[model samples]
Structure formats: C-alpha cells, structure tokens
Target: MLPPELPPLPALTRAEGELIDRYLEVLDLLGRINPARNSGTYTGLRAAQALVTKAAALRDALTVMHNRGESELHGETLARALRVLDGERRAGLVTVPPPADN
Candidate 1:
C-alpha cells in the first residue's frame, strides 16, 4: 500500500531541500551496486560502500545539527561531503554530481 501524503515541511529551506535531494541521488547510485553480493571483485565495491556510508554519516550528522538548532554548520559539512563525492564522480566512480548550483 502507498503511504499517505502529508503537508509540506516548513523548516526546510531551499538549500536544505536541495541537500536532501542530493542525498536521495547518492542513495540511488549506491543502491544500483550490489556491494554484498559482488564477490568476484570486492575492492571497488568495498570502496563504494565506504563512500556511501560516509556520505550517509554526514547526512545523519546534519540532521542532528539541524535538530539542535545548529543548522548553520550543515551547509559547510554537507558541501565537504558532496565535494568528496564530486571528486569520485569526476574520476568516473559514480554518476551523481555534487551540489553544483549551491
């Protein structure tokens, strides 16, 4: 069954909304790779897993910071994480672009 739709959130600024979108993009890219099942060549998969895990950790950290009213720090932290992913993308490791317009 489909979940019920709710009203839009009031707390999320456009910047935060974009970051959330980026988070989904990152997850989608990682989900396409079967990290656990790929046994033939584990090294690249493991690195990708590590990259996604670290990105997720940064997202989680931003959530905590936002909840604590210290959301000012989220932009820089998320940018750093996105920058790392952008480097990987430029190296042809992933497809999602970093938060370019932000």
Candidate 2:
C-alpha cells in the first residue's frame, strides 16, 4: 500500500470504504479455508490461501503508511496503494471505481 498522507486519512468515500470492507471479508473467507482438504471444494480455498497473501501484505503496508504524515505520501508510494486496491478488485474481493462519484 502507498504511504498514506501525513494525516493518514486518505479521504476515502463511503463507496471506497465499502470496497475495503468487501476485501476484508474476502480475506476473512480465505482465512477460514483449510489447506489440508483433499476434495474439489478445497480448490477455491487453496486459491484463496495463495491470494490472501497479497491482501495481507496490503493490509500491513496500509497500516504502516497510515502512520505517516498526510503530506508524506506522493507519486510512487501513493501509486502502490492504488495498485494494491486494484489488485483487491482484480481478485474479486472488492469492486473497482466505486459506483457513486465522489
């Protein structure tokens, strides 16, 4: 995730918050999945297990970035968060470009 602005608020809209919430839910689902299952039902879980790593990384990065001053984040660092958010959408954990315009 990109380094958050110095204040670390990120000015997220409600839609953006919802998207983040969805991604969290997906991550939770992945956490619930077990790696030892030998059945086909475990396939998606296995996939989730692998994919959740990205989400976990994003979560950690965001936590760190948010601790920074609001003005500290710019360009490349901010881009990283955008990329991770996009990855969340691509992974079907969240929706992209939120429906309502901010």
How high a TM-score does candidate 2 get?
A: 0.30
User: What residue pairs are clashing in model 1?
Assistant: none
Q: What TM-score fits each model?
A: 0.32, 0.30
Best by lDDT: 1
Evaluate all candidate structures by whole-model CA lDDT and list the values in order: 0.53, 0.49
lDDT of 2 by residue, 74-94 (tens): 545444444555534344432
Among all windows of 10 consecutive residues in model 2, the one with the lowest summed lDDT is 89-98
On the 0 to 100 scale, the lDDT of residue 95 in model 1 is 44
Give the C-alpha lDDT of model 2: 0.49
What's the lDDT for residue 87 in model 1? 29
Top model by TM-score, which number? Answer: 1
Q: Which stretches of candidate 1 lie over 4 Å from their true place?
A: 1-3, 37-102
Model 1 weakest 10-residue run by lDDT: 87-96
